[model samples]
Each structure stands twice: as structure tokens, then as C-alpha cells.
Target: MRRLLLFSGLVGALASCTTASESTTSTKPDRDPVAHSTIVECILYDGMTKTSPQLVTVTAGTEVQITDTVDYYFMKARVVKDGKTYSGYLQRQCFGK
Candidate 1:
């Protein structure tokens, strides 16, 4: 029957059209255990990143490790006082050149 043929054709067509999939996993490299690392001083930061709930402020000349520079204004750094790495945005230039 024509209906049976059409159904078979449709099934065949759908079977021929296979979907290929590719998987990828992204992992950030470790930039810690810095040796001879250049420390940066916090010049100005409005308590912390606006997104963070806890407001943390660092005084001038605070020792910090600039890990990943997200952009010209913000960078991922570790505050030496807390001993925990945090991603915070900096409002003013605070690092020593």
C-alpha cells in the first residue's frame, strides 16, 4: 500500500539522518604555589565585588597574588590575609608597577 511505503520511507529517512554529538570539558590550570611572585597592593575596592554577599576591604599596600586577569578592571586574586583565593573586582589601580 502507498501508506505503508510512505511510512517505511519516512522511517528510513529518519534512521539515515543520524545526529553526531561531541563532548568537551573545560578545566582551569593551577597558577598557585607562586615562587618569586610579585605582590600587588590594594589601592581601592568598594568593600568587595558587588556580587559577593560578604563585604571585604583591603587596606592600601595589602599583599595579594594576581592570579587570572579577567579584564582591565577586575582580576582573580588571592588575598594573603584570608589565605583563600577570591575573584573580586578592583575599582582603582592598587598594584605596584
Candidate 2:
């Protein structure tokens, strides 16, 4: 009777351990869409003497809609206008691209 109880306890502990490990391993990481929207409304500049660039003063909570994915050191973005829009490229790090 003692041996049987010990064996059952061991089996239950092992089963729970295996279930916990399986749950952890089965989890998938969150994925971002290939093309998505982002809002970056700031200016960054690389100075001749500065090792890293600096972000210039920008309006607080400025929201500009970015309509594409970043695929280069610089990414092109368009500014919305009533009649026409202007497009330009900004450094990837500046906008977390």
C-alpha cells in the first residue's frame, strides 16, 4: 500500500510538470503585420561632431499616419495635404522604423 501511494504521487507530479512545460513551449510570439500604420512626428538630425543624431523639438502628441513598412536605412513617408501631398525619407532609428 505504501509503495502504491508513493508511485501515484510521483506520477501526478510528473504529469503536472509535463503539462506546465508543454503550455510554455506551445505559446507563439506576437507578430506584426507586413504593412501597417505608424505615427512618427519628429525630426532627427546627425551633426558633424555628435556621435549620435538628435531629435529636434516637435509638437507634443503629434500624430502622422505612416502607411508602409520600413525596408531601408531611410524610409519614405508622405504628409497629407488638402490638394497634394509631399513625400520624404527619414532615418529608420528616428521613427523606430
Candidate 3:
């Protein structure tokens, strides 16, 4: 059930590619390097809160790139840690900045 729900959410996220792509492309090619952020604490990835299907426990101080903000608590972000890049929904409150 968890995997199914996560899969469905990912499909929904893909359907909104225009929005995600728009935000991703907003990054400046020149001066502005991709902003870096770290998970200030552990966060529960309920899957529904994020659009990604791959469910994994995000540990404290994990580095990531904010892809877009979905609301006050949820954000579309790319997890960049341990030599892996994962795109998903991360809680904004869990980040250090």
C-alpha cells in the first residue's frame, strides 16, 4: 500500500512536470551556484508528503538541493548525499537552510 501510494504520487508529480521544470530551470547558469541545504534533523517521509516513490529515511545533516516549495511544510528537493541523487518531497522544517 505504501509503495502504491508513493507510485501514484510520483505519477501526479510527473504530470506536473511543467511546474517542476520551470522551477528547476530558474537556476542561473552563471554566477549563482546551485544552492546547498542540509537536513537539520531526521524527517518522516510519509510518501504522500512527497512526490517521489523511493522511500528512505533521511538522516540528520543530509545535504540536498531545494527543487521547489510545495507549501509551508513540503518542498520538492533533490537529495544529494552518499553519492546518490534522489528527487522527492522533503519537509522544509527539517532543513537547516
Q: Please tell me which predicted candidate would have the highest lDDT against the true structure.
A: 3
RMSD of 3: 17.6
Q: Alpha-carbon error at 49 in model 1, in Å?
A: 5.9
The residue-by-residue lDDT of candidate 3 on 20-63, one tens digit each, is 77674556645422455555654435453555455456777666
Tens-digit lDDT track for model 1 on 1-97? 9999999999887766653223244465766633123234343232345454543566665656665566666656555446654544554355544
lDDT of 2 by residue, 1-97 (tens): 9999999999999999998987845467554322323345445323322244543422334334443434656544454335454444344544442
Whose lDDT is higher: candidate 2's or candidate 3's?
Answer: 3
Order candidates by TM-score, high to low: 3, 1, 2
**Candidate 2, after superposition: displacement of residue 42 in Å?**
1.0
RMSD of 2: 10.8
| lDDT, candidate 1, at 48 | 47
Number of the candidate with higher TM-score, 1 or 2: 1
Candidate 2 local accuracy as lDDT? Answer: 0.48
RMSD of each: 7.0, 10.8, 17.6
Per-residue lDDT of 23 in model 1:
25
The alpha-carbon deviation from the true structure for residue 75 of candidate 3, after best TM-score superposition, in angstroms, is 0.5
